[model samples]
Target: MITVKVPLQEAERAKQELMRQGYFLSGYSVQKEGDHLYFPVKERFDSPYAFEERALEARPEQPQGLRETLKGKLPADVLGRLKTAYDQVGDIAILEIDDKFKGYDATIGKALLDTNPKLRTVLAKATGHEGAYRTQHMRLLAGEDKRVAVHKENGVSLIVDVEAVYFSARLSTERKRIMERVQPGERVLVMFSGCGPYTCTLAKNTEAEEVVGVEINPRGHELAEENSKLNELTNVKNYKGDVREIVPELGEFDRILMPLPRSAETFLDVALGASHQGTIIHFYSFLHEDDYAQADTWIQGVCDRAGRRFELLGSVKCGQQAPRVFRWCTDVKIL
Candidate 1:
């Protein structure tokens, strides 16, 4: 094998240059000697580093992802239909399988468990989010029978009941984004806070004076309180009730978060009512790409009803809800 011999200090830079010029070979481990390194290459060209013929060990094969693990186990047609994207909440894997691949749930789940040794449970979405709580039904396809899982993100531990409460690990980045924007001594409110993912994340990561969360679902509220205690957060409070009923009584806030994407517009009046001058509100909604301006319109309408002047601070695309539709957060500042 052809190898480029360079000092340990220059090895990284030299290796990058070699790879960029199509000289470095793949699937081989670099060899190290006293104060020197040998990177395998396809062919030797004139260089500052010395060239030598030396045998090198092959690198270990990369671990297979979920789809790669299920390739041979599932039929070609079914495998093509399977979406590899899954939500991993703690040791639980939440999957969404198309109805056409109905009977293969167990097999798919087993393959997932086999591929991921850390996973203790595999659940398939039995139904879409339903009812007032927006909780979805999940079927146990493999592993443990329980639905409870401890999901940790942004330096906080959240105990979530996947079947009883709505939670999304996908929004961890969004939660962190909101947390970073929180100012010191600011009081933050999270409406429709499910299992305290956003509430706990903000309380744990930010310098906010206090963080209050309101959840209508009993299970979600219970877990939110539990999560606050679990993280040993002293500046956190969880309320079990509708935001419309609870937010007004909590008084004014420095910042407010409305995470209910499906119908967050319905509660904009409540959010605006609980805001004071210069208060920043992160209002989330599901809207198509072309109609994203509708979110700003909703905010304007609510501000008009409340007789409060406001400034639109722009929007963020949190995640995709459909092909062309996205979960958007429209940031607004009360004036």
Candidate 2:
């Protein structure tokens, strides 16, 4: 077999480039030699790395994905409407199927299960997030009939009840980003913290003096406490109540996180009440790409009304909620 010999420092970049060009051979493990790595390939190609002949070990073939498994099983028009992307929470897969394909949901769910053997259950979104808790209903389409899942991220385990709580596994990277930004011994507050994903992640991964979470939803708060215990974190505390009523009692914090993208602006005063001078606030909002700057304006308006000076640190597009609309995070520092 032909192999691409690359230095350990350049292995990742070389491998990615080769894979992008459809030259990297799959089903075989990359061989590592002292100070160097060899990537198995089908044929010699023009590259900076030297191509050499070597016998490589073959690994088990990867399983087919939902799209591949459903090919020929469903009509092309229907298959095209099926999005391969699904939110995976531990052993559960949460799918978003269009209402037009309601009749074929079971077939699609079964195909997903066949493709991903590790998934223990599959659910379809039954309704949009609603009520005071922002929790949504889920219809079990395959596997076990359970809504609870134990999700692990950023060295912390979270007990999430999909039907009773609002939790997004998609925010794992954003949670990690906030965790990495936390300074040692700083007190952090997470508003609308569901299942303690942010609070527990910071507690487990950062040396923060204390990480506090306030959740309005009773079920979310209960799970938040359970998750803190599940992760064996002692520096975390959770309070169940409206932020407007609970935040004033918690005093000031060095950092405050507002993760409620929708209507988070309505609670800006509560978050501001818990922030002191030099405090950093991460505010989340959903807005069209063209109007993203509106988030900054909202923060500015709130600060003006509070008679507080603030400086915009940065803004990031965390995830897309719709076409050209995104979940955005705007970071600011109170002056």
Candidate 3:
């Protein structure tokens, strides 16, 4: 598919024309590239740069009753099962369910599409998760992609134009990917595990003997349990309570995922003293790339206070945050 970048006015005009005709808008992205604004569209595979080029060759005229293609029908039984939690936006269908889900799967996404015999090639399941369905009507995410399952990330997923939200760092996908570096067969202590993303991912993806996930929030605790079941991860446990009181009592661990980005550095003492030789303490922060050396100095200072040394394991780009603010995680091995 051709990814074309155009101006906003052009994009709106193109979008209207595409809908007025019979063409489907596959991908839509309006982004800021340095000083220029761009609207990117994914072109039809067999078409020219303009969708009209393809329309010219195949149908001479814009086909009749194009909106009929969108109001595609699904089975009554399916709609009955989905309840009234679904809202249709043009060709896209969205389902909103209040869930602290156990794990992610396709069976959970039975509402993204309906078997529609109305179009030549049904364009269902195109609009995945969006940001509008957040709990308490708090606008957190743009929306959940309907086609992409968070657990099915072993495969391809949709792309989203993410925005900054208050306390949204706790929900970042970087928190999930960096946890992949954790070695197997290690007892992990994940403080502030949120919804157990790191805990369950570690358990299900590794051969860990035990993973103790701790969260203080009651709703988070319930969501963690649900996430544990969703991923079907074994050898993992979720403890619902503040970790400051609970962590010291849990004894020692070979690894720790200190994920509370704002104060992850403050927990360094607990991580160092609680760790044995070769233990890795994964820490995330809002520091700039140049500040990594400063972060290392600070971490090593904690190591020195604890009568130990640490080996810096470097950092990587998690995702983009706001203007000039990016989130990154650095690993250090305890000596």
Tens-digit lDDT track of model 1 for 1-335? 98988877555445534643457676788899999999888886756568899989998744345677787889998888788667878789888888778789889899889866878999999999999998899888899998998876667788999989998877766787887799999999999988899888888888989999999999899899889899999999999998888888999999999999999999999988898999999999999999999999998888888788999898989888999999999999999
- State the TM-score for model 3: 0.54
Candidate 2, residues 1-335: lDDT per residue as tens digits?
A: 99999878545445544643457787888899999999988798656568888888999956435776788989999998787667878778888888888888888889888876767999999999999899899998888999998876656778889889999877776887898899999999999998899999999999999999999999999999999888899999999998899889999999999999999999898888898899999999999999999988998899999899899999998888999999999999999
lDDT of 3 by residue, 1-335 (tens): 23334344234333333443335433333344443334233345322123222211122332222223223343444434432222222233333433422122233333223222121111122233233221122121123443212222221121211111112322324544655566667899988776566776677767778999887766566767876777666788999876777888888898888776566788788777678888888787777655656567768889888788878887755533455556667787887
Query: Pick by TM-score: which candidate is best?
Result: 2
- lDDT over C-alpha atoms for residue 199 of model 3: 72
lDDT of 3 at 229: 74
Model 1, runs deviating above 4 Å: 1-58
Candidate 2: deviation at residue 238, Å? 0.5
Candidate 2 lDDT score at position 31: 93
Please report, in order, the local distance difference test score of every candidate based on alpha carbons: 0.85, 0.87, 0.52
Model 1 local distance difference test score: 0.85
Ranking by lDDT: 2, 1, 3
Better of 1 and 2 by TM-score: 2
C-alpha displacement of 154 in model 2, angstroms?
Answer: 0.8
Error of 1 at 247 (Å): 1.2
